[model samples]
Target chain A: MDEPEVEAMDEPEVEAMDEPEVEAPGAPGAPGAPGRGVRERRLHPVTPLRRAWAPVAVGAGWAVHDPDGAYRQVTDLALWTLLLAGGGLVVAAALYGFLSWWFTHFAVTDTELRIRTGLLFRRTAHIRLDRLQAVDVNQPLLARVAGVAKLKMDVIGTDSKDELAYLSEKDAAALRAELLARAAGFAPETAQDVGEAPVANLVHVPPRQLAVSLLLTGSTWVLLVAALAVPPVLWLTTHSPGLVIGTGLPLLGAAGASSVGKFVKEYDWRVGESPDGLRLDHGLLDKEHETVPPGRVQTVRIVEPLLWRRRGWVRVELDVAGSSNSVLVPVAPRELAVEVIARILPGVTVPEAEALSRPPERSKWCVPVWWRGHGLAVTDAVFATRHGLLGRTLALVPHAKVQSVRLTQGPWERRNGVADVHVETGANTTVAARLRDAAEAELLLQAQADRSRTGRRTARPDRWMAQ
Target chain B: MTQQPGDRYGTEGSAAAADAPPGETASPEPVWRSLPRSMLTLRRLLLVVWMVPLAVAAGLLLGLLAGPAWAAFAALPLALLLWGWPLLGRNWRSWRYAERADDLLIQRGVLWREETIVPYGRMQLVEVESGPLQRKFGLASLQLHTAAAATDATIPGLDPREAERLRDRLTELGEARSAGL
Candidate 1:
C-alpha cells in the first residue's frame, strides 16, 4: 500500500523532502525531523574519468590494430594518427560518462534510501532502511587511484544492484556506518558512535602462503602437465614450431592469466570482528570491504583440498545471507579455521569425525570411491555433512537457518537402497549427505524438520540490535 | 488418477485440524491430494497446438526440397506426442502434496523421485496464478515460495475456487508461523 504511493509520485526530486512523513508512517527513523533528511547528492566529480578508462583502453587497442601488416613496426605517421584517434575517443566516452553521472542522484531520508538514475527513461529505486541487510565498500583499481570508492547495499527480498559509485572513501565509510545504525534502529544523534566502534582483527592471510596454495591447486597442476606434454607432442607430430606457437601460447597465456587474476583478487585477505558484525577486507586490484551482520550467516563450509590437507590447511567459506563475498578465510590452519567458525556461530561445535553417521556398507555401490568419506551429523544447533573426494568439504548449516529439507533418489540410487538428503538454506551453499540408507534418510528428514522447528523458536530475533 | 469435483479435499474443516497441538500424535495416514485430470487434457492440447503446425511445415518443406521420402521425418513430432501422452499421465499421477501439522510435503518426479518438505514458518509468499489458457479451462496453479530458490513447489491444474482457498489458508498459516531467514 505504501509502495504504490511512493511509485506514483511523479516529481520525486522536488517533493521527496516532505513526501515521506505523510506517505510512509511505519518506516524506520523519526520522520519530519529538521535537518535530518539528507539532501540529494551527486557522486564524486572524478567518477566520469574513472568510469571512462575501460572504454579508452578498448579504443586504444582497436586503433593500434593494423590489418595490412600484422607484425610491422608502427611508422611515425601511424603513431600520430593513433594518438589523435584515441584522444577523440576518450573525449567522447568521457562526455557520455559525465552525462550519466549528472543524471544519477541519491539521497537518504528518515525511512528509506532513494536512488534516481537514467537520462531519458528516469527510474527511482527505494530501499527501506529497516530491510537493509549489509553494506559493501568497493574500490576498483582506477577508482582507488582517483581516491574514490563505491558503496553497495544489500536489501532484503531484492537482488543487490543498488550501488553508489565514486564516493569519497571517507564519505562512503561514514554513510555505511549511518545506514547500519539506522537499520539497527538507532536514533540519528546516537548513530555517530557506531562509526567509532572498535574492531578486533581475527585472521590475516599471508600473501606468500596464498600464492603457494594457488599453485598447489588441481587446475594449476593440470595446466602444468598440459604445458609440459603438449609442446613436445606438437613438435613430433606437426614438425612445425609455428603450429605449437599458435595453439600452445594461447593456452599457456589463459592459464597464466587466470592464476594471476586469482593471485590479485585474493592478495591480502583479512577478517576482523566488531560489535556490529564481522568485517572482511580483501583484494589487491579491486579492494573490497564487506560487513556480515551477526546472525546473517546461513551456512559455513570448510574445504580441504588433497594437497592442502598434507599441509594442514583449509579454506573457510561462509554463506552470508546477502553479501556475495563468502570467503571467511581463504587459507588457514585447521585450528584457526575452527576458531573463525566458532566466532561466527557461537556455542556451536563443528561435528567431529567420530560423531558422523557413515552410510551403510551396502550403499557403497552408489559411490564406491567417496562413500567412506560421506557422513552426516545432526547436532542440536546445526546440521553438518562431509563429502567430496579430491577435496573434502565439511558444510555446517545452523538449524534455525534451514529454509527447507529435501530427499532425492535416482534410479540407480533406488536400486542400491540409498538416497541423498539436502539441507537447503537461503544461500547457495547447501549441506547434503550423499548415499545414505533410504530408511535412515527418511528418519533424518523428519528429525531435521523437528529440529528446525525448535531451532526457529529459540533462534535470535531478526533485529539483533533491538534484542 | 483423475479426482472428480466431489472428491476434492474439503478445505473448510482443515483449519481446525491444522491448528491442533503439535504434540498430538501424528496422523497415521496424511491425506494426499492429487491434481485434477483436466491438467492432462490441457497439456495435451498445448502439445498439439505447438507441434501440429511445425509438423505440417516440416512435411511440406522436405517434400518439396529433398523428395517425399524425407517428408517421413515430419512424423517425429507426432511420434513424440504419442510417446508423451501416457508419460504425462503417469507424471501427473506422481504429483501429490500433503499438508502436515508443521510443514507441507511435495513429492514429484517419475525417474528421479524428489520429496521437498517446506516448513510453514519458512514460507515467504504464496501465489495463485492463472494464465489465459488456464483461466479459459477454469483452472489455476498455486505456488509456494520460500527463501531458498530450490524449494520450487507449484501445484498446477487446480479448480480456481480450490486454488484461492488453498492460497488464503497457506498465507494465514505462513503469517502465524512466520520466522526470520
Candidate 2:
C-alpha cells in the first residue's frame, strides 16, 4: 500500500522480536487505531498563556516558606528576589514558546509522527504510523480550557517509553484517528492491547461506591474506630463525663473529614477501553490517566491488600514492555479482574487461587512476591518486627521478559543470615522478593524465570498471520 | 500443565532481526555528522547550576560583609552555572544513532555507560526529541524504540536533519523487513 511506503520512510518503533521482518501495514492505521489526523501546515503553534504563572506561583510559595534565611544576603537583594521572580516568568515564557513551537511543528506524516524539541540539543523521534498501538488522550481542567491535550502513545515493537507529551486536543484527536487506521501487527510476538470497550452500565458504584472504594483504602476506617474509642479514653483523662462526651463529638467530626477526603480521591474513577486500548483515570492528589494496548503489556500483577481480601477486591496492572512502564487499574472485583485480564492474554490462567486466610488486618510490613505467591513466603524482612504497614501484592511477570535473579542482604538483614531473594521477571523492570533462604531463593528464581519463559513460549501462535 | 499444539508462542529469534545479509552497515551522512562542542558555552551554561547555591550563600555572607545588597546579586553566574552544568553535560554526553544492518545502535548517558541495541526486525518506532537546548544546537536526538524497556532502549543525540534522515532509513528498513516476514 502507499502508506506502507511512507511508513518505510518513518522511524521504526516497537519491541525487538527475532521474527523475519515483513511489509508492515500502511500508515492509514488498521481499523481499531486510536485518534487519527495529519498535519497540513508549517505554522507556529498557539501555546497556552497561563503556564507562565505556575513557576511564578511555585517561586512565590517557596519564597513564603523561605522567609527564614533563604535569602538573607543582597548581592542585590531586591535584584535577586526580582530575578527569582523573573526567572519563573522567563521559564514560563520560554516553555510556552517551547510548547507552542512543539505543538505546531509536531506532525505525523504519511509514515511517522515527528517532534522537534529543544534549541540546543535538538532531538526528533518518529513512531511508525503503522506501529501505533494505542493513543491515550488526557485532559486536565486547565488543559481542557486551554484546548490542549496530552497524548500518550503505545505501539508495537516499542517498550513503555513515555510517548510524545503534549498536543492540541484537535491534533491529538486527528493523531488518534490516523493511528487507528494502521493499528495492525507490527510486532510478531506480543499481544496487542486491544479490548472490547466495557458496555456502559448504570449500576456502577454510586456516591456510596465511591465511599466504599475508599472505606478500606482511606484513613477513614481508622478514624472511625478511633472515634468510637475516644469517648471513654477522654472520660478517663478528664474525670468528667461531660468533657469526654464533648471530646467524643470532635472525634466524629474527624471521621467525617477523613471520609470526604477519600471520596474526593476516588471521584469519577473509570476503567474502560478506547479504540486503541484500556483507558483508566482516577486519583485526586497526583491525578493519573493512562492507556495500554494488549500487545505492549509485558506482565500482569494482581494485588489484594490483606484487608481487601474479605471483599474479594484486587488491583490490576501490567508491566508493559519494561520497568517504569505500566498500566494500572487500582481496584477490580476479583472475578471481573480475572476475566478482563484473561481476555487480554488468553493464554494466562488465574488458576483458582484463594486469598490468604486471616491475614493480619494491619501488619508492620507487606511484601510483593515473584510468583502470585499463592500465599507463600520468600523471606522475612523487617526494619524491625515493629515496622512496615501490612499489605499483600501479587506480581505477574510475563514469560517473554525475564531478566535476572538475585537475593538481597540489607544492612539490617545482615545480622540475620537470611537474604531477600529476588526473582526478576521482565526485560526492563523485574519484580523481586526477599527469600530468607538465599541459596534456595536463587534456585527458585532461576527455576521460576525458566517456567515463565516456558509459559510465554507456549503462548505463541504458530499461525500468527492467519487472521 | 498440558501444552496445547499451537501454544508455542515464539522461537529463539522472537524479537531480534533474523534475516539480513550478514554484516552490512548503513551509509553515513556528511551534513549532520558530529555534535557541536564549545567548551566556553559549556562552562558558561553549567556554571549557572553549579554556582547557584554557593552564590546564594555567598550573597548571604556578602550581605553580612558588603551587606545583603550584594549577596544575592553576586550569585547570578553561580546559579546559572549550577543549573547549566548538567544540562551541558547531558548534551555533551549523549551519542547519536548509527543505522546498522541488523540493529540500531544508540549510545547515550552522562556518567553511566549505556548502549542500546535495537534490532530492526524488533523495532516498533523511532522518535525524535528536541528540548530547549536542541533548538539552539540545531540538533535532535533520534530514539530507537524497542520492546526492551519503555525509556531504557533509546539513542538520544543527533542533528535534527540527520535524525530525520535516519528515521526514514529505519522505517523503510523496518517496512521492507516486516513485509518480507
Candidate 3:
C-alpha cells in the first residue's frame, strides 16, 4: 500500500507541469518562494483515522443489527482466528484511507485555487479567485476533537467540490482569510487581517429561546398530538398494550431525536455585521462560520409560526446564490429580524402595516381559509408576498434579483377567475402571490417583467471588490 | 371573425391587450407561433409503439390465465391510445412561443394554463436537443435555461432549421443583455 501510494503522489507533479502556469508579476508570494508562493500542502496526518471512522462505525452497526446470528458465527470461529480477521480488516481500511489522503494535494495561486484528488481517476478542480462567492469553515464533532476543520469555498455557477478537509483549525481560519483577501483583489502582503475587522454583534439567540422555538415548530406539535392520541386509541381498539408500545416508542423517539438534532445544530446562533458581509456563527458539536456578502443575497423570508406569533418572534432566512438557503436569525424579535434583513439588503424595508392587495372577494371561493392571509405588495425595489394560515411566510425578493416571472391558472382557478403569479429568483426563495384576480395576475406578470428590466439596468456589478 | 378553439382560452390577441398596464398604450400583439403539425404525428407514432407491445402482452397473459373473454383486457391500451390521439393534438396546439422585445413568452397546457416569461438578459444557457426519432422526423427542441431552475421553458417539435435559428438568436440576445446572477 505504501509503495503504490508513493508512486501515485508523484503523478500529480508530472501532470501539473504539463499545464500552463501564469505566475502573477510582483506577487509577494511567487511560485519559487519557499514559505509564501504556491505552496502545495497535504491535509493533516490524522485524515486517515478520521476517514476510516465512518465506515468502521457503519460495519459495527450492521453486525449489531443481528446480534444472535453474529454471536453464533463468531463462536463458530476460533478466538485467535476471529481476532486476526478483525485486525486484518482494520489494517486494510486504514491503508486504503491513508493512500487516498496521500494522493490529494491543493495549492492557492494568485489567480486560482487548484485542488487535485482521487486515486485511480484523478479529478482536478481549478476555481478562479475572481469567481469566488463565499468562504466557510466547518468543524464536525470528531474533527473538532482532533483540532482540525474543513475549508469550503463557494464559486459562482459551480456545484460544491471546492472543499479541503482536516486542516488544523487555526490553519483553516488563516487560509479562509487569505482566500477571501485574494478574492477581494488584494496582494498577499497587503491583505488586511479579516479577523481583526470590527464586527457589530447583531443578534445572539439564547439557548432557552432556541429550545422553545424548536418545541413550538409545527412538526413538533403534530407529533405530540399523535403520540398522545394514537396509543390510547390503539389500546382501546386492539386491547393489546404491546402493540401500542411498539407503535408509540418509535414515534416518540423520532420526534425527540429530530428536535435534539435541530437544537444542537442551531445552538448559540449569532449574527454580526462586518465589512465583508453578514457573519453567522453557530453549532454545538460542529462549529460553522459563514459569511453572506450582501450582493449575493437573492431573497429574504420572514416566517411567523402560529405559536410564535403571540410571542412576537420570527425566523429569518435568506437565499444566497451559489449556496444553500441559510438562516440569518433562527429565532429573534420582529425588530431584530427586520434589522438583519435591512443589513443584508440595503435600501429595502420590511413592510409592517402596509395595505397589500388581497385577492378579489370572488377568488375566496378557491382558497376559503387562506384567502385572507394571501397578499401581494409591489414596491420599487422589492416584490413582497404573504401567505399561509397556521404559519405566515413573507417572501421578499428584490426586483434586481428576479430571474423570471410566470402566470399559472388551473381549471378550478379559471372558473373562479383567479390565477397565481410566481416571481422567481436564482435561489430557492420565490415570491408566489397565490389566488389573485386573473386580470390582476396578468398585469402583475407584465409589470414585474418591466420592473426587473429596469432593476437589472441599475443593478450593482457582480464583482463586489471592484466597486 | 370566426372563433378558433384556442381563442376560447384567451391565449392570443385579447389576452395581450389585457396584459398591458392601465396607462401604457397597448403594445402590438405578439405573433404567437404554434408547434409543427408533424409533432402530433410523431407523438401518435411513439404512443402506438409503446401501447402495442403492452396490449399484446396483456392479451396473451389474460388468454393463457383466464379465458378468451378476459383477453378483452388488451383493449385497455388500445382505448388509451385512441383517447390520447385527439388529446395529444390539443396539447400540441396549446404549445405556443413568442419572442418579444426583451423577453420570451411560452404559453402551454390545456387544463392548467401556464405562461412563462423568461427575460433575454436572465437567460444563462440555451440548448437544442434532438433524439434519433426526432431527427428522422425533422424536428428538434429548444430549451431555455435561466439562473432560476423554476424557469423551465421548452419549445418542442420545431423544424430543425427553425430550432437552430432560434437557438442562435436567443444565445446572441442572452450574451448582449447578459446580467450576471
Candidate maximizing DockQ: 3
Clashing pairs in 3: none
Write the residue-wise lDDT of candidate 3 on A365-419 in tens digits: 8888679898877666788889887888898998889999999999999999999
Off by over 4 Å in 3: A1-37, A156-162, A187-189, A192-196, A228-246, B1-28, B44-86
Model 1 C-alpha lDDT per residue in residues A1-467, reported as the tens digit of each score: 12233234322322234433242322223232224335666788887875587786774575567534533433535877868876888888888789878777777654577776666666678887655666789998978887889998876544544789889988898888877775665654566457844689999999999999898788776876787679889999989989888878877876776577778888899989986678888999899998776778899999999999899999998887667677889899999988888988976888777888788887778888679899877666788899887789999999888998888999899998999999889775567888878877877776676666657766655445653
Docking class of 3: acceptable
RMSD of each: 8.1, 17.0, 8.7
Query: What's the lDDT for candidate 1?
Result: 0.77
| Model 2 C-alpha lDDT per residue in residues B1-181, reported as the tens digit of each score | 2333232212322222233243352232212233445433534544655576677677777888886667767657665666666666675646444455544544444433333344454455778888777567565666655444433444444567777887898887765544110
lDDT (CA) per prediction = 0.77, 0.49, 0.78
Error of 2 at B99 (Å): 29
Local error of candidate 2 at A78, Å? 14
Task: Quote each prediction's TM-score.
Answer: 0.81, 0.47, 0.83
Per-candidate clashes come to 0, 136, 0
The candidate scoring highest on TM-score is: 3
